[model samples]
Target: MEQLLYITIGGSTHTATMVSNAATEALLTRLKSSPVTVTLNSSGGFEIWGALGFSLPATDEPVNAQPGDIVLYNGSNICMFYGTNSWSYTRLGKIDGLSESELRTFLKAGESNVKVTLSLSNTAGLQSVDGSVAKSNGSAYTLSGTSACAGQKGVCIKNKKKIIR
Candidate 1:
């Protein structure tokens, strides 16, 4: 199933989809309640690999990564890309709704050592409170849609255990 991950940098938050795999699931499990923080570094001659740092305490050798992509480097580090890289990396997720330029700008904001966050978004269809995806009615759920969360099949805000499918 597709999973939604929120990437917050400073004040701006970007939406991303976690790739289906052992590493992704493990990462999510670690981040189920709280997010992990790490320093993001700006790299490459043209800053194509912006915010290209952080470690997740998990690892898997996957192969490679590209622009707008998030990956696990050597098993425990989270690498967000503004440019492409050839290496053994497990993909974490891909940020949505941002152009190449927009992504580059956001990632390269500080040029070095920027902080980023990864959190779970209920739209990931993690299953209802009873471990089922059945529709939970009432104000517990709302359809507050946004460009970042486009093509959503359902939406549930923070502090509420509700899902619309």
Candidate 2:
């Protein structure tokens, strides 16, 4: 199934349709634990780019990125376009339901240190490995009866209560 990723900037949230790839998979795994916030700066009069503070697998290819395109650069940085650019980048996803002008305004084009938070839309209908419904128990845990750490994903137990991270 196609996954939707949410990007929030300046109190407005936008959705992106994620591509099915190792890089995107890794991103989703990270977000399952917590949202990622990056400080981006406008660049080349075309895009806002920044470091992700972590690396994802890169399968770079030549791409003529258009407005709303989000791509991974050098395995660690993220670039969100508001204009145009041609480069070798790992395709991440594209922001949905916005026009060019709206994208520019939403991205705060030409601005520096713009805060962008990436998260997963609330996951519904999630099932555990044993085909059980998942719930929250105030704390998170793993299905193996262990505590779910900050970076762990999947079904977990919290005080013996089932939860999905």
Error of 2 at 67 (Å): 0.4
- Writing each residue's lDDT as its tens digit, candidate 2 over 1-165 gives 989997877655667999999999999999999888899999999999999999999999999999999999999999999999999999999999789999999899999999988988522212343323223444564433334578666655555465566
Query: How do all models score by TM-score?
Result: 0.64, 0.73
- Candidate 1 per-residue lDDT over residues 1-165, each given as its tens digit: 788887766545667888888778877887786766567777662232323343344546755566688877666556777776677767778888787778887676337777776677523323234312223332233222212233345554423444444
- Which clashing pairs does model 1 show? 55-77, 56-76, 58-75, 59-75
Give the per-residue Cα lDDT of candidate 2 at 2: 89
Winning model by TM-score? 2
Question: In order, what lDDT does every prediction score?
Answer: 0.61, 0.82
Error of 2 at 14 (Å): 0.7
Clash totals for all candidate models: 4, 3
**TM-score quality measure for candidate 2:** 0.73
